[model samples]
Target: MGATAIVTRFAPSPTGHLHLGHAHSALFAWRRAREAGGRFLLRIEDIDPLRCRPEFTEAILEDLAWLGLDWDGEVRVQSAHLPEYRRALDALAARGLLYPCFCTRADIAREIAAAASAPHGPDGPLYPGTCRRLSAAERAVRLAAGEAHALRLDMAAALALLPAPLSFAEGGTRIACDPAQFGDAVLARKDVPASYHLCVTHDDALQGITLVTRGADLRPATHLHRLLQHLMGWPEPAYAHHPLITDATGRRLAKRDRAATLRDLRAAGRSPAEVRALAGWPD
Candidate 1:
């Protein structure tokens, strides 16, 4: 492939310390941008105020610098950009593609259990269309009562608004999109103003990101993201979903595995070069 001016971003949620898996992802995005002489940007996805912490955000920057990863512009902090996401949500709402969902986790599970067989999606058993069936009066009453609710994309309605056979560029190939599988994915939750799908798609477009590099686990989400981009009339960026780094036991690295954290490895006297090699990136 010829060198193109791509703009890639390493967006990490500040929920925990940086692990080897994070190192590999950050390095993967950084390498792709550096190789093409593109811009590598950093973004802090700290929308979840309950789980995310300022200390972890600072640690992420420190750990990435320690791993010899340097990004190009000022980091885009999602928590600091609420209005942007709100505007995107408002746009979808105005088009009658979004509805307020009042179902709790237990409520959803109960509804799914009542069904003969609940359909499964990328996130798990798809959300049963409980709130989508509510009468306008009932919805208005709940909103008047100040009931906690989430904004979900009415998959069927949103699909009706867009043209069929949505697709996105992946590794120079056009992959067909299947967004209905998500089944009314949440765009804004009661706790967080914006969900991952909403924030990521909005930020990628606003930041002018030309290339999105992440783990293969999130590849399924690209389908929904492509739909969101189309709905909001945002440009679709090329995607590169790399395989996740796994442990000796073949399990993917996670925050619970403290031994795999960069801080632990650094404390064990491992140099940056050694850590980079361990993270599957050798200088």
Candidate 2:
């Protein structure tokens, strides 16, 4: 591969089967790499052990192959790289850019409900910073006691560490990033050691992916991802967020929505070509 090779990837969580939206995103990335004579990679994002199953991961690979999409390298599974994510968390902690968050969902909801003002973020109500105020001794005691907690980024501290404003390339334009709106984003938790934000950014840098193509819904997350790349000194990847594939009623195709899976269509006698067209890739 040359220095200017355009590497792209299609990373999907294995919580469920691949629907039309997944097909569209995968096809988009694969075409971008194949057309440019670059590399297209596959990654299984199975960080959430409780939700992700091996069977789903297997099904994803089969579906992609059946769709006539071929990738360039061995699929990178996120679960197999726990230590790498841990090191990232440790590095952030060393800089005092991370703190243990002991609040559970119920605790956070109660705090937000009782508060006079709780600002909202792209996902929902932002964290109220209850544990962000814990004293060093108190935090140490709780950590030593093995209390369940999640690691949250000290957003303000992280921003302060930045030498200048952050931005990323998108379709030949630079978009400025403001990660502060995420408000102390979670990096790791008791149940899940790493988060999507942390893992995606780390893997993109590790894999040398030059372009990131995904659904438009995740565009907001690019801001936080940019911050992580800047903090870790990772090369910034140009992003091309595509519009989601929706059904007749405008609902996006999703496994939770019981949208038609590729296998479902295949079983119903729909050929691969038909499915590709349905996924918005006629050719």
Candidate 3:
């Protein structure tokens, strides 16, 4: 991976105002691209229609411009690329790696409660895989009845499809992958056409991203992403999961921390340079 053309992206969901934490992540990607004389891109992960807002997207563009971070190429908005994600899901479905899961939150909880033990994962208790055992007739009946359902990856089947010992490059180090830990992760929700894991991997490959830079918090998701890339035959990009920005209290900054927002800081007469420094990226 020496001296390869590095194309990196800073993708943020427009759920709220751009906070300091977002600034740090964006700057991290931007600086890496600039340092290598590569391209920096921006993408809006606005797939969740209920939470995402157009105003927030506009504010993101404005905030990044104010921070003096200019990206190359048109920003890829995930909401606008539903067809691509759909196609990816279709490919996996064709390979028998995906299945329709009709389990609602209440249904899953009921099954988990009935079970003596529930396996835990990084996110939470793993999905009990109740719907994965549904017979063909039962699934057809649910489908015919117009019952809502999400598309879930058959983790065991997917892993079996791939060769043993799947891995990815993390800061030039080869890290082994364990996608099975996610326990049949959702690929596409009933409401949304695709999940974060699906869309991000798809876009990275489509955009030919050579380096994926984001917060270390998403490192766990990388193992699963590696599996998706391998299954989809997408190019594996080098990953650099940077440390997250935190507040004085040692808590990770979030949208709820309005005072740490670029908008709030700008309103308080802080210069762009000052705000950049606050985000831990001083020129």
- Best prediction by lDDT: 2
Per-model CA lDDT versus the true structure:
0.93, 0.94, 0.92
lDDT of 1 by residue, 184-218 (tens): 99999989999999999999999889999999999
Cα distance off (Å), candidate 1, residue 203: 0.3
Candidate 2 similarity to native, TM-score:
0.99
How far in Å is the alpha carbon of 145 misplaced in model 1? Answer: 0.9
Candidate 2's displacement at residue 93, Å, is 0.7
Regions of candidate 1 where Cα sits further than 4 Å from its true position: 1-4
The regions of model 2 sitting more than 4 angstroms off are: none
lDDT of 2 by residue, 44-109 (tens): 999999999999999999999999999987999999999999998899899899999999999999
Q: Each model's RMSD to truth, in Å? A: 1.7, 0.8, 1.6
Colliding pairs, model 3: none
Q: TM-score each candidate.
A: 0.97, 0.99, 0.97
Ranking by TM-score: 2, 1, 3
